[model samples]
Target: MGIAVTAPIILGLTLEHLEVGLALCFGAFWCSPSNVSGSLNHKMKGILLSALLIMVVSFFGGYLHYKTWLILPVLGFLTFGIAFISVYGFRASLISFSGLLALVLSFAHTSQELEIYQYALLIGVGGLWYLLLVVIWHYINPKAQTEEILAETFILTAKFLETRGQLVGQQTNREALQTKLLNLQSELVEHHATLRDILIQSRKSSGISYYKGKRLLVFVQLVEMLETAIANPVNYEKMDVLFKQHPGYINSFQDFIFEMAQQLRFIAEFGNDIKKLPKSKELSICFEKIKEEVGLLKTSEGKADYEDYLMLQNLLEYQEKQFNKIKKIKWLLGNPDMDAKDFIDRNESKRFIVSQDYNPKVLLRNLSFRSNIFKHSLRLAVTVMIGYVVGNFFAFQNPYWILLTIIVIMRPSYGLTKTRSKDRIIGTLIGGAIASGMVLLIQNPYIYGGLGVVSLIIAFSMVQRNYKASAAFITLSVVFIYAIIQPDITAVIQFRIIDTILGAALSFMSMLWLWPAWGFLEIGKNIETSVVANKDFLGKISHFYQHKGKVPTSYKLSRKTAFLETSNLNAAFQRMTQEPKSKQKHLDKIYELVELNHTFLSSLASLSSYIQFHPTTEASERFKMAITKIDDNLSQVITSLNGGKSQNMASTILQGDVFFKEQLAHEKLFLAQEDKHLERHDQEAHLVWEQLRWLYTISGSMLKLTSSIDFD
Candidate 1:
């Protein structure tokens, strides 16, 4: 981004065509945000589309600027049209933002030396030049992004594990821990999506070279590690009770989990440098301590406490599995030549990579009052037009600054727009004050220009990661740029602050009154989608258990869908919390639903992971019955949320509990025989039966909750 912005200024200075250079720089600056992580093909398409949109908007914006009567209608239409493009997906949203930015800036004719067409042409060239640089950088370090993202994934997973470890302590607030887990899961889901895009697309484009294959294997391990961690879900209440009698056992397990998290963080920190990679800690000692503690408990309590013993055993098994996953990741990192053919085939791999729907029908379908994006587009257009009118009424210099603030601060949701408005106001004020001090204290055009360039670079880099800081730098950059040309820098700074404040106030009000889409109004759909995904995931797990072969792509796809939908639900609930208390209808019920959905997914992960690893009995009739009941419950939950009459499953639930208890009792009889070495099938059946019973119980709870809530 720095290179893209500065190269134009340097060239313009050398040729004494500073306006032309700044025009190119403006084009590059607008396009730079779209230069995000993705496949080479995706990146190229986004950048190219952004460049085209910018050029088109620039030309029209300039052509329409002088027509006072047409300005309002054209501005409204252009804003709505540009914002509507976001219906396609994330990259499209960024491109749409770039286009809106260009449109607003088009009204500002800084160069009397160049024609509108010439300025547009220069900006387009700048965008293309940036694209060229991006391609070169991509080719030069193709794997760097993948590695860095993967490393971040490791760190997040570690935090997740660490949070889970906290649940082992009896003093911890289970609700708080669960909230933290949900938040971490959200972050991990995004990282996983990005990895799928990078790793899957890279393999497809370049074929599976050794390094790519190694990275793919490591990614696979990271994903499975997350599943393993999720699979280790415990009944914190049960754990707390157990802690009363076996505190040492619980503490041992907590320490072991923490140790695992530390190891993961170490790998994240040094995994890129093979020579500096830390050696895996020997956890066998920790494992022994846990085992010894459990052993003593078993000895003291005998078979009377077999259930508690089994819980500890299950915890140990999950810990061991997670440890092995970490080890496998380390090995894959060390041995780059390891075969990747055993992993998902190339064609099958593409199924996991989410592709954007570019069909025109998608856009048409969303162009309605019912569509959130449609409403957002309309709101944005009206708000931007209002900003323009206010700016003109006040006769503020650079009236487009108000439009720019509206464009940048307003979002699809009230919570986001409110937050961004606050950040923008704060950042603009601070940045303007500092810049004003600098301009007064120092009178060097050279230094101002240099500072502007540096500020622009930092602003661009921090836009996604730190919006407040990014806003500050952006203010500094803009002020410094104007300082170089305009003598009354103080006026420019004052107008910038006033424009931002006015824009933010207008944006906040617009979201509240302009056909607002409250989070509660949309959260039910998110919950329904998540439940449906979980239902599909359960079906896949049942099929996998019946077939018992290589994990199918369909199974993986269902798991991905479940994870993503759950993340969406979490995000929706968060947004709801940030809205007006009155608008946040049924906040408690919605939160409960979110928690239940997340727990259900985690439970599914546990069942899926166990079947994938340990031997299990064939999908028996009883297992099928349990799965059927669970599936029906989830389906009914969806039906209720969608405002349909759902069938009562009270009798089925009662029958399921009785049947499961009877089966568990029968299975335990075999294991209760101290002298008898139970066959492997009996042991497996015992574990699978336990998981089925737990899932059935949880599903019933979800059904009950949904039935009581008024989704409308």
Candidate 2:
């Protein structure tokens, strides 16, 4: 609003009043969309760029400088360049829009042009105003982005726990939990994107971790298991038995889920009041159950157990590990360390939009998006073309109406198209009716300027508030503008209505003809490509680890590749989910796969980190050799996956304890060979080979696990 006022003022100061009006109208409407999605920095830069570009384009195009319809496309090309820099491909609506806006305004009451110098003066003033308003908005709410991030992150954590909780109980719905987990993972990605932005602005850590992440991942796995069970509910009794057999684990899971929900609620409030949760009663109960249930499974003379009882033992261990991680987090900045502020800086923080991928293609569809690109584009183009022709024919008598028709009709989203079309028609009609009444009721009017201000208010309010209310307000304002402009009331009102109807019809028809391009499909495919790249990186890591001790640059690249891949896929999915009709089975699967892939890779990374910290020694060389050999087999699995080959584990590998013992024998033999070889005065070389072999075997297996998750 300030920009609209100040732009004309600056122009009026530099040139003529008529020139100031054109400059104000052109610049104000040219870059009008509220840029709530972008940051303060982004909005500032984008508005400036948009203001400059529109000034240059509208200036050339406004004075009828081009006889041909080249101006719109040229404007589009410039907008695209701007979008490339700003990263707003879909929301920006480039060339088609430029023509649509300028033509409608020009065709309507003849628009006066600004002098080039006047336009330049207004441009600077308008840009500054835009910058000012955005700054003021931020000043009122500096931590808006941070709060949004924290809220989203907390929501996902609760969701993860809920899904996992169901998996633990006897009467739990497995299929629903699996779907819930996929949804949770999708939320996690969105949270991360938000976190990246907060990190960029305020270096706040989003408390995600190896254990919690893996828990969610494993939840999905359990859901997968449950889904299989759901398909055969006849085995309900058996499933219930499995649940009863692990009461300790089930109780712990419930406690974890409940605790997580409480934590999330706190975080979502964006408050630093960490909960002093009571000591988990689940732990005490679980200990009692373990003594009774598992004790029965163990033989009198040996540490033996029923298979389910053994599973219970493993489950307990997992619970403790999870709790420990949570405890560690509780110890660190659980109170939101204010001192951490001094450590944060703008440039050092990562931004939300920063990623390995950007979707630029206008014709791509998001995941599971059913809308066909070429067909949709063709349909829209034809409709828009029809609008253009119809608009031209009607413009001679009611040029303003003709342009409005086209602009009102060209909606990208079907629902939005419907709403906007109806609103434009109504607003125009109301404006016409108001114009007719005022011209008839009053003798003279100089109210157009005041009405223009009212129209601006209505436009801004309606855009963010309710669509219908906004349209109604705009209609009133437009009618007011027309009545105050001149005394020829009846003819002008009728003319205005006709022009609007024609413009509306042209817009509606053109959309039916020429197809608007999509930006989702290209993004989706690119996301798929990233996933492939991630798998390759993991495979390379596994294979390379088999040959070296220190992680090479190649391994770092692989880790970076994994991060990049997930980010790309997640972003594409986020866009898809934003559209209506996105909740479908295919989308669910894509999301699930994304979750699965992230979990597997993060685990491998975490596992690798663990290995780096803890090294082997001569005192435990025998066990080290055994573990290394086991890890080697995992490496073979990675190679198979990388080459797109089938994985066929020998049954012996699945023999568990027996197989492990046999591998230990091999490790001992290798260690003995190394010891003897080192004694020959080549100790350093032998030690180097030992370290390399350790890295190759252990790291290789971890990488293989990462790849297999993707390959499968």
Candidate 3:
């Protein structure tokens, strides 16, 4: 904001009108709020990339505006390329920034044949000014931004944990809890992506000290564990039954989880100076009480009760491990010199090299009709062409605003497009009113400039956090820029309001009718993808166990991919909820499918957690058969999702296989012998059997879920 407002004002004194102001404001907008963090080198690279792209886009955009004949094909191709490459991370950010700047600049400037070069240069200059400001900002405190972003990641995780704790309450609304969890999952996915970038940047950065670098590496490990630990939390209803007589234990357990979250948040807040933080003794005490409660129930319990007790034991142990992990992170935060290489290597660490993949083959693959990017690109092209022609015919004061709005507002889905349209319209009206009132009351140029600067800063800060607020401030800043040029602010506000509504309407209609992609149809594919990812992850874990050596790179990659795909699936489910009920066919089946997948993953995590403790344990043939059957069932389920025949073949794999019954009989015989020998229950044996039971349950759940869906 300082650079945007000050550079323009500083140059405006020498230049003619507020053209420099508009150019600088947009230049700053396109360059600000970068995902790349840490070193000045990376920051400058991002800024220069944006500037170069802006220049090229601006040059071609000028011609497309002048020669109406070329607008459709040229802009359509650009849209297709930009939208297709956006599937890769970080590329979308730069592409949108360049595209928006070019669209706005080319139309706003009345380009003369010889002055076209000057126009592109002006845009580059504006971007360079922003780059300079950003470089200066980075040097001021290079580590501060990364630290703040890391803090936000922790805070968001805490919020997600707190929401999960709410699910444990007996009186809570199940649907509401599920909805909140989905929203939190979506948000956490976004935060994880941002944090991944920060970690990647820090790893590549030569700017920070070795202490800071290792700390960043440890943080990366910490966040990855966080995802797994919380992935499939204990069922609240089961816990409720376990604590039927003593609900206080349930409350204490919930509070303990919440306290653990608070400790994480404190670590985020205190950073490297965490000595003053209060230790959480409540969790330890609660664990003891729960232990006592379980012991008391043991005397009156049956075999089922004993099984529940074992499950509870596992749950308490896992929670304790998580708590200790948090404490360990806090310790690492304070003592950054501690050797973290082993911890990092165990996860198969890789260096972060940030670069865009503009390979021709990748782009060509995405051009297929089946690609969502291709469909979205075609939709955007049609909408923009229509919007531009209509705006030119009507001769709105700022006709480019219509094109810009359509570009920003039109998403691939109706739900997103409608949501954006509402936010855009509401934000525009509020901004227009605020700007008009400000112009009426304040006549001082300096004050107007200052407020605009502040508004820009606020908007940048809130862009990722809150879009509606960001939009409002964006409107105010843009209007202030116009106010500096035009005497009558009313006309500017009126034109902005009308242009926004028109653009939003066009975008909404286009998304609703043009290449419409219904959520239900796409959701099945997401489910299949998630299942495949989970299967790969499980296979990798099994290989790791059998090898009994260093954890393989495939294990880590599969784990990350599985979680990422799950997040994507969750996002699709959330979007499906937002679409019209009529369009949301088999909603219950989709919901059930998602829930079953989550449950299956969590069960896998439970198995993996045990394997982490006993990596050398040989798998029984029974366990192997169960996994094989589950894998086969997953394949069948995927085929069914893709509209294949159901085959009506019930998987009696678990039901007919005598492995589980034989295992249970063997355990009983062993326990009977142990009773005679006055021995305790075998912990490792119990864990293996528990995991086997969970696999069987997941298999049954999958079968039920597949039955619920209608492929026809």
Candidates in order, TM-scores: namely 0.95, 0.55, 0.89
Q: For model 3, how does the per-residue alpha-carbon lDDT over 1-712 read when each residue is reduced to its tens digit?
A: 5666476756765675556565565556555544254346556776787777777777677677555666767766776555554555454555554656466547776644336666667777777888887767767976777787677777777777777767665755877877777677767766666555555555555433565556666566466555656544767777768677456667766877788788778877876575755465766776677667666545544766665666566666666676777666666776745765445442234422224576677667877667676787788888887877788889889988988888777777778888889988998899888888889999887787778788878887876667777778989987887787788889888999999999999998887778877787688889889999888877877676666676666676677677778888988988888888888888887788888887777777766666765635676676677677667667767777777744544545445246677778888787666642221347667666766666666756676677568744
Q: Where does candidate 2 stray beyond 4 Å? A: 1-40, 64-124, 136-141, 160-184, 201-241, 244-252, 270-386, 394-528, 536-564, 570-712
Question: What TM-score would you give candidate 2 relative to the actual structure?
Answer: 0.55
- lDDT for every model? 0.85, 0.48, 0.70
> Model 2 over residues 52-78: C-alpha lDDT tens digits?
665555455445434337544543343
By TM-score: ranked, best first: 1, 3, 2
RMSD values for the candidates in order, in angstroms, are 2.2, 11.5, 3.4
lDDT of 1: 0.85
The best candidate in terms of lDDT:
1
> lDDT per residue, candidate 1, 258-326, as tens digits?
888988888888887777665655566787888787766555546546667767877787888888888
Ranking by lDDT: 1, 3, 2
Model 3 residue 324 CA deviation (Å) reads 0.7
C-alpha RMSD (angstroms) for model 1: 2.2
